[model samples]
Target: MKKSTLTQDNIWMKEPEEHDFPAAQDYLELLLVPDAAKKIVEDLKKAPTIIKKSKDILRASRLPLLPETNIHVKENLKKVQKNKKLSPILLMRGQNDLIIADGYHRLCCSYYLTEDMDVPCRLV
Candidate 1:
């Protein structure tokens, strides 16, 4: 399996942005099952639980990375490099798995930067 390319040594870090929430909501709506998406959106309306977790933790929590999404991940990595501040990734708890509602690419990029790197996320 190909590992993520992100590493903390090289990652261009930035704070979270305001627009990230809406973007995450939209992405989750498109990516998740309707019921799951609805729940997530409703959860987002309330205050999100902010957590700083390692890339390794996120990798273990999320679904496997698909090959088709690699290009988009790379693009996001570049965007992060250019602009350090990115919106926080959105995560949801499922019966047995953690869901990434948005910012998969950003997560991958952060993982590539360093597995142990701490990533801030808004999890519901």
Candidate 2:
């Protein structure tokens, strides 16, 4: 599929920055073995970007909506408010709930902006 540096909304979605994978690996390592985490990151790199609803992602992941007071959430909100491009979120399917290996803050920020927002993401 063709990948663009933009999404179909005012809240932009671009390809993940270089450091995004490492961050995903670091966070995944906390919940998995080093090799497994490494593998997932690699898979995510090859994964295609697709769109899903912000509320659906939150529901599948079962993560609570972080308050706007959260520092990271605030930062993400600031970026969006300024029309800065946001990286598409990276996701991994766990045995049960989905794992938001990275982009939790951005996801939360989008949720606050619009629960029905179409979140561009790479789900593995």
Candidate 3:
């Protein structure tokens, strides 16, 4: 009987594909310990995914002059304004949320270079 923290509760019961590991499968069939059962659920909760937005963004800085290539700036601005309530100002982050990993210039341009617009951002 193999015992692992991941088998605490029947957490494995909820997620079957996770038992690709031979040891976890063995735990399911032969070894059923109370402590290990609880740990499995905690591990599942910690399993990371594309992280969600953890905080609200701030839009206070001034925008910049529009570039010749930004012909669609006006249209984008209208789209942002139309859905102002539903959409949130996009921001990128590093380890801590709100750390702008990219889009510094583009975001600045959107606000200053063109009319106010909602900008999308991706953080790593």
Residues 32-106, candidate 3, lDDT per residue (tens digit)? 354553344334334432322212232322223455356454444444344321121222232343433223333
Expressed as tens digits, the lDDT of each residue in 28-60 for candidate 2 is: 999999999999999999998899998999999
lDDT of 3 at 114: 26
State each model's CA lDDT, in order: 0.61, 0.86, 0.31
List CA RMSD, all candidates: 5.4, 5.0, 20.2
lDDT of 1 by residue, 12-113 (tens): 334345566667667777767767676776676465546465555465576665343489777765666664444566677666777776677777766665
As a TM-score, model 1 comes out at 0.64
TM-score of each: 0.64, 0.91, 0.24
Which consecutive 10 residues in model 3 have the weakest lDDT in total?
Answer: 5-14
Candidate 2 vs candidate 3: the TM-score winner is 2
Alpha carbon lDDT at 117, candidate 1 = 60
TM-score of 3: 0.24
